[model samples]
Target: MSLTHLDARGAAHMVDVADKPESRREASASGYIRMRPATLALLAEEGLPKGDVLATARIAGIQAAKRTHELIPLCHALALSKVSVDFELDSVTSCVRVTANCRLNGRTGVEMEALTAVSVACLTLYDMCKAVDKDMQIGDIHLDSKRGGVSGDYNRADTYTEQPTPIVAASAEAGRVPLALEGERTPSVRVKCLAELRERFGVSELSVPFHELASANVAGLKLALKNQYERFIDIDDQRLLCAVNQSMANDDTPLTHDDEVAFFPPVTGG
Candidate 1:
C-alpha cells in the first residue's frame, strides 16, 4: 500500500482528513513505571522532593495529549473533548501502572493522543522520582482500545505475562512505545544501550519484545527497540550505530543469549 504521508514524488505531505466524517472517537492506552521498592515507598509517604508525583504526572499527561500534534509530525491536531489519566500502584512489583483515555469528536482516532498521554505521564513520573531512583523504567506503552472509526473497535485482552514475555505483533499494538529499562521489567532476553545511545534516547536502557533473538544480529535488535520500544514511527534503522560488549560491533555482528549490545546514531561535529 502507498504511504499516506508521501506524495507522488516521495515528498512528505499530510493526508487530508477533512473529507472523513466526524465521529465521537475515544482511545485508551497504558504503561508502567518500575522502580525500587524504596522509591515506591518514598512516593507513598510523600517524601519525594516533588510535592505530588502522581498529580504532576496526571497534569503532564493531559497537557501532552493536547499537544500531541506538536511532538509528532504529520499528526493532525484535533480539539480533544476529554483526556483522563490515572495511576494504580502495585507494590508487589514496585510498578506504577498508568492508564490514559482521550476522547474527541473528530475525523481521526485519538490513539496518538492516548499513547502520548501515557508516555509523558510515565516520563514525568521517572523525572520526579529519578532523584532517588535513577534506574526507573518506563515500559509497555500500548493502546488498550479505541472506538469510533472506519476500522471499528480494538481491545488488547492479553497484556503483561506470568512469563513477562514481550507482546508480539497484533494490530492493537500499533504505535506502542516499549521503552523499558532494567529492574525486572521482562523475563525474555533484553537489549540495552551503552553511553552514547543511552544519552540520546534519554534512558540508560530499553528492551525489545522478542521471545528469541535467533540468528538476528545487532541491527535487528536496534530495529526492535527503536520501532517497538521507542515508538518512533519514522525511525530509519540505518542511521543507528551499534556495539557489543565494550567494543564496537557492526550490524553484521552475531548475537547470543545474555549479550549486552549498545546502540547510538552517528555523530557529526564541525
Candidate 2:
C-alpha cells in the first residue's frame, strides 16, 4: 500500500506495515565524518576525555537502530536481533568511516534503522567533541544494502556517493544572511535543533505528558535536548552536552543530579 507517513495527498505520513509478514531481514548502512587530523589523533589516543569514542559509538549505533521509529515518522518498529557498527580511520581524507548492520525477523525492512543508527552514532561523536571543533561535520548517513521481506534484496550502486544533507541551514528572513559560520545566532541553529529533536524524540510536536513547560517557550534547542532526554535539570550547556554524550557513550543511566537538571536517554526495552 501507499506510505501512511505521507498524507492523503501523498505528502509525508508514517507507512503502516501491519499487513506485511514477519521474515528474517537484514540491512547494512554506512556513513563518514571528515574531521581534523588533530581530532583523529586525539580520538586514536583517547584524548577526548569522553571515554572510548568507538565503543560508545557502537552502543549509540545499536540504540539508534532500536529507536528508529522514535526518529523517523511512520517507520515501523522491528525487533532487531543483531546490530553491528564498525569504524575505520581513513588516513587519506582524515575521516572516520562508520558502517552499521541490522538484522531482525519482521514484516518491514530495517534499512531506516540501520542508517539511523549510523547517523545518530556519528552525531553523538560530533557532539562529544563539538566544543573543540564546531566545524566537524557528520556525513554520509545512508542505507548501503538490504535483504528480506517484500522489498527483497537491494544495495546501493555507488560505494562512494555523497552523503545525504541531514543538516540544512534554515531559510533566513529577507535582507539577512542565512545562518553560517560566525554570525549572530540565526534561525538555522534553531531549525537544526528542531529537526534533530523530531528525530530523537518520538513526539512530532514536542508535546509530552510530563513536560513542565509548554513546547512554544522552548526558545531554542534546550527544548530539543529536553525532548530527547525527557527532563532537563538546571545545568550549563557544556555540562549538559557532556552528560548526554556520556550517557550515549556508555548506555548507562540517565543523568540525575540532587540539585541539578539531567538529560535522560530514551528508555530502552528490557
Candidate 3:
C-alpha cells in the first residue's frame, strides 16, 4: 500500500484532504499508568503532593488532543468538536486506566487526537505521582475505536490477558510459601536493571539463585543485591520500579525460581 504521509518521490509530506467530503469523525483511545498501592491510596485520598492529579491529567489530555498536530509531524489540524478524558483506578493492579474520546466533523479521522490525549494523560498521572512513586509505568496506549471516513469504522478487540497470579500454599513455619506447579521447575530468578540503573550497575542482566535470597520475595532480592554490591547502597526502593514476569509488582510480591525480575527507574515520555 502507498504511504498516505509520503509523496511519490518518497519525501515525507502531509496528506491533503481538501477534496474529500467532511464527515462526523470520532475516535477513542485508552492506556494505563501503574503505580505503587501506597501512591494510589494517596491519590484516592487527594493527599498527594500534587493537588487533584486526576483533574490535572484530564485537562492535560484535553489540551493534548487539541494540539496533537503540533507534537506529531505531517498531521493535519482539525477543529475538534468534543474531547473527553476519563480515569479508573484499579487497586487489584495498582494502576490507573485512562480513556480519551475525540470527535470532529472533518474529512480526516480523529484517531491521532484521541491517542495523543490518552498518552499525555498517562504521562500526567505519572508526573503527579512521581514524587512518591518513582517506579510507576505508563503503557498499553492504543486506539480503541474509530468511526467515519472512507476507511469505514474500526473497533479493537478485547484481547488483553491478565498475568496469572502466583500460587501459594500455607506452611506452618513459613506462613505462606509459593509452590511450584506440577511439572514446573524454578531453579533461579533472572534479574534485569534497565536504563540508568543498568548503567550504574555496569550490567544489564544477572541471575540470583532462588535459595540464595534472604527471603523468596522482591524485598529479599533487593536486600540481597544491596548486601552484595556497594552500588546498590545509594538506591532507594521507593525510587525503583519493578516487574515480575512482565507484570508490575511491589516489594512484597511473591517470587519463585525461574521468574523474570526487572528493576528500573520511572519512565518518561509524551
Top candidate on TM-score is 1
Per-residue alpha-carbon lDDT of model 3 for 51-138, expressed as tens digits?
9999999999999999999998767888999999999999999999999999999999999999999999999998888999999999
Model 1: CA > 4 A from native: 158-214, 217-270
Candidate 2 lDDT tens digits, 30-79: 99987898998888888887878888888998998999988776677778
> Which candidate number has the best lDDT?
3
Candidate 2 vs. true structure, TM-score = 0.55
TM-score, every prediction: 0.61, 0.55, 0.59
**lDDT accuracy of residue 235 in candidate 2:** 20
**Per-residue lDDT tens digits of candidate 1, residues 135-184?**
99889988899999888888777433323433322222345534343344
Which lDDT value does model 2 have at 260? 19
Residue 71 of model 1: what lDDT? Answer: 94
Model 1, TM vs. native: 0.61
Per-model C-alpha lDDT, please? 0.73, 0.59, 0.79
In order of TM-score, best first, we have 1, 3, 2
Which stretches in model 3 have alpha-carbon errors above 4 Å?
A: 158-270
